[model samples]
Target: MVDKFPAEQQRIVKGLQDAVDRLNTIARGVAPIKVNKASEYFDLPEASPAAPGSGVRLYSGGGKFTVKTSANKTVTIPMADVANPANFTSPSTQTGDFASASAYTQLRADCARLHDTVRDLQNAMRAAGLMG
Candidate 1:
């Protein structure tokens, strides 16, 4: 139990919890993706206040969704997933440097797996009629 931790450690944990809660709140308001004008059916973020000019833009003639970050990094999401947002595999990036190239690559793969898990959860929710 948290009660076993020293008072100082408990305070630190509480601080981290507060920080996570704040981040979650910010994530909730993130702008949705904007699909390219040429794309007949796709949705991507219009802007990401978090990434500033790195707002997501759609491309691939509605077959792909691309997002460019200020750091010149690009992320692509499948058009099918964009059309069915519930199935989108939202990627995550680790903040720190990796110990080796292999480590980095594995981490990236793990992140993809996490996204797949998210899609699975979404499917379960929809099957239960929890989502429309």
Candidate 2:
């Protein structure tokens, strides 16, 4: 085939064959380019606030993932806290003896316990960066 073509045409054919061979090699994963580093991954830009009834938009910025809903509500999740679950501590249990008191006293104690539980939950959420 080389002998059938002129010198210039033969060079062009060789170049084309070389290009095809390189593509085939890549397709077969013989010389694949690996993306092992975080920097090599594609980064998604922060999205604008979603329009009403348009659904939600999610993106990452300032070390947090922001999800903007069509209702104009934004929920920001800190990536650092999510990536490290071991850093989150369970809220301490609040104990009270509701059965040991009179009916009215017990009711008050129960309400106080419920309030304490709610406060503990809120504190836990704040500490875990789940709330402001």
In terms of TM-score, the best-performing candidate is 2
State the C-alpha lDDT per candidate. 0.57, 0.63
Best by lDDT: 2
TM-score for each model: 0.25, 0.29
lDDT of 2 at 6: 69
Displacement of the residue 129 alpha carbon in candidate 1, Å: 0.8
Off by over 4 Å in 1: 1-99
In Å, residue 13's CA in model 1 sits off its true spot by: 70
* Candidate 2: segments with Cα more than 4 A from true spot: 1-42, 80-132
What is residue 6's positional error in candidate 2, in angstroms? Answer: 46
User: For residues 1-132, could you state the per-residue lDDT of candidate 1 as single tens digits?
Assistant: 566667689789889999999999999999876644554754554543333365543334334445555665545543223122233232345445545576666666766776877787677656544465
Q: How displaced is residue 72 in candidate 2, in Å?
A: 0.5
lDDT of 2 by residue, 1-132 (tens): 456666689789889999999998888986656667565557668656554577877776555677777877776764332222122132233247434445556456666666766776676668655787
- Kindly give the stretch of ten consecutive residues in candidate 1 with the minimal lDDT sum: 79-88
